[model samples]
Target: MGGAFVAAALLARLGGRIGLPTIPLFILAGILLGPNTPGFVLVADPHDLEMLSALGLVLLLFYLGLEFHMDDLKQGGRRMALAGGTYLLLNVGAGLAFGFLTGWGTREALVLAGVLGISSSAIVTKILVDLGRVGSPETKPILGIIVVEDVFLAVYLAILQPLLSGTNGPGDAALKAAKALAFLLLLAAAARYGTKIIGRLFDTRDNELLVISFLGAAVLVAGVSEWFGVADAIGAFMVGLMLGSTTSAKRIMTLVHPLRDAFGAIFFFAFGLSIDPGDLPSVAGPVAIAVALTIVMNVLAGLATAKMYDFGRGPAGRVATTLLARGEFALILATMAASAGLNPRLSPFIAGYVLVLAVLGPLAAGRSDWLARVRPGEPQPELVGAGK
Candidate 1:
């Protein structure tokens, strides 16, 4: 654990000197020193850091929830939903098409659709903070899209699990879907109407007690959410959302920074540790095609979002690049596919695809201005007439 932190920090510092983002650097550190690599293995088993990594994800989303107020949702509710729906339709739909085109089994294709569809919430949240764009106009839609994806994930998992298991009937899948929807609605209602009750729960003056109270609630709620077939990240996020309305939101935010950064680093590093560089070579061709597809689709989605929100090219570029990385969810799907014995090639394809984008996403987002300048546009009326 100590070695993981030191290595990530050192690599991130080196990358910072060159204006590179810390996210990929942290993952790179883990890959270099992990068991898969032929070098000094800091932790032989990736599972050793699983608990810490999970905490990192929870806190990251929790912080995101705190920062996202209920008013933002109220203001952009319909637009946000439409934008998010558009993004999913383009990316996930493309993924399904690509999956079928691969001649892989139907189950493998379903896994690929999810792998190609969703963005990494952890990486996206981290990029917003690192780039100092947390409060930027573009971030709201980006976050809203993630919220929509989270809910979609719950439904998708319910559908996918039954198919993969091959034992459960449609009734079972429907039951899971209902439970997931119920849990989400329950949390949404709490965020809407139970702010006072939640606020009082964390109203203690002592910092220690306050921390324990909020942390316990987040983790407990997150665990229960998993039982209800929802992603724990959303659970933690909803906890943050509910508490965000309370007077203590600022206090919780201030206290969670170090925890989020520390655990978040661990999450990325652990992700890298699970990848075997050896597995990437065979899937290089497919991975390249998938990466290209994801980039193109994200740009279109970004433009669509910008048009909906009446934003300029710069904001469009931010939306496209910030949501480029694919991490935890892809990995989870890969793991599930492997367990279900779907296809031998699916895991390697996902690994290579994720590794490429994990590095590229942050780099592109940091330089999103390039996309704006390079994009073709009609000449300005003033410049055209004056030059003429």
Candidate 2:
């Protein structure tokens, strides 16, 4: 873990110079320390990394949800839903089609579709915030799309868990899904109505108590979500949504940002630690093919989404680029595949693919202004018009 931190910091510095995300760098550092790589700092115990990694992922999702206020749907419901729905449908369709074309079976194809359809909410949201695009015209719809994808993420996992676990029959699958759905609905209702209770208890002036309350709520909810067969990420996210509704949301966000970055680094590093670098060589070709497909599809779907939201060509193109980076969620899905024994090859293949695209995705987004060649319609700021 000590070595992982040092390696990630160095790689992140390198990534900053090259317009890549620190996530891929973190992962690359782990891969270098993996069994297959002849590195001085190999990870001796992968299990120890799992809990921290899970916490990192959970925090990342929670931060994202916190940043995205629930009021957004009231402001931009139709367009956001339509645009996000469009992206999901198209990307999933494309993923399934490609999976079938390449002779990956139905189950593999479904998993692949999930792997393809979802973008890394953590990465893209962070990038947008860092780039100061959080207030841009395109941001509203982009965030909306992320929220929609997250909703589907919970549903997909709920449905997939039973199948992957090899439950006895259809009855078992239905029962598991019912349990998950009921829990999720309860969570949603809590986020809606329970905010007042939280506001009363936690919306206080005591900064230390405030911090404890926020962290405690997120972690407790995440554990409960896991207990009920719902993904812990979902629980953290829903907790975030509830927290964000409070008057103390900004203070909570400020306090949590540092924690998110620290644990988020572990999450990415652990992904790389899980992979055997020696296996990457055999998977490179397929990984490249998959990357190409996702990039093209993301651009198309993302562009349409931006246009539907009435963004200019430049912002639309930028939105497409922003959508390219697939981080935590992809890794999560890939890891799920590996754990279930449903598709061993899927894990390695996706690990390699994510390494490349994770880098390329951010690089492309950083330079997205190259595609902003349009008649000067709406005057834009220097950053939106041209890359610095």
Candidate 3:
């Protein structure tokens, strides 16, 4: 554990100096020092650390929600609906086609398609925030779309559990689906109503109290989601989204910022540690194809969505380019795949691909303005609040 911390810290510091996201570097370091690599082997028991990593992910989503205001959601509702819906449909369709061509079974195909259809909200939001583009007009719709996607991911995971757990018959599947939907509705209500009450409790400006409250809400929601047999990350994300609509979300974020960073760092490090090098050689080809297809389909989907929103080609292109990277959702899917015993061969490849995209996406976001400027026959980039 001590060795892992020191290595992670060194990698993070080096990554910062080179303008790379720390997550990828942490992953690389883990791969190097992990059981797979020969130079230095530092393996920690994952069972001991999984809870901490999970908490970190929860805090990460909470911070993402705090960054947005209710008005952002209200204003971008239509765009989000259009963009998120279309993106999911197109990417899932593409994934199904690929799966059929690759000879995967129907069930596996659906799982694969669902995995590919989702982009990394955690990664995208973090990149946008780091780049100071979170408040930009382009980002508003993108994030709005991501918010919707996060909900969809939760629902999808709920649907997937029955399929993976070997619950037979269409009746069982339908019943599970209904139960999942009911649970989701209940969760939304809790976010809307329960968070409001929780928000009021933070009226006093005690930072420690605020942090505890914020984390407590995350755990409560995650626990409830798990009890309902839905994915914990989904529950945590919903909690954040609910708090996001409240005026005090930002204050809570501010209070928990340090904790979030520390735990979030550990989360990424754990991600690194989880990659198994032995599996890479076997899955490399398929994983590369999957990653490439994911980037292409998502980018096109983003472009199509941007055009529908009446964004000019350059801005639309920027949006498409920026949205191509995947991170958190991919990690979540990899975790699900591992749990299902579906295909351990594919998980590390997907994880590595996601880490690579995490690095690339932020750099693209950082260059979006320059890209827009350089594109011919494109309108000037519009500031996020200009029209509003």
**Best lDDT among the predictions, by candidate number:** 1
Name the regions of candidate 2 deviating beyond 4 angstroms. 102-105, 129-135, 310-312, 369-384
Clashing pairs in 3: 137-384
Residues 1-388, candidate 3, lDDT per residue (tens digit)?
Answer: 5677788889889888977877677667767776656676777555556877788777776666566444665677676878878888887788778766667466667667766777766567666776666666577678767766765676788787667655669998787777767887886776666766756765667767766777897889888876676777777767777777666777776777887777776676677677777777776777778768876776677667767776765556557666767766666666666677775555676766676677777676666554444344736546342222
**Stretch of 10 with least lDDT, candidate 2:** 379-388
lDDT-sorted candidate list, best first: 1, 2, 3
- TM-score for each model: 0.83, 0.90, 0.84
Error of 2 at 88 (Å): 1.0
For candidate 1, the lDDT comes to 0.82
* Per-residue lDDT over 23-90 for candidate 1, one digit per residue giving the tens place of the 0 to 100 score: 66777788889899996889999899988988887887788778777676467689998998999999
What is the C-alpha RMSD, rounded to one decimal, of candidate 1?
4.3
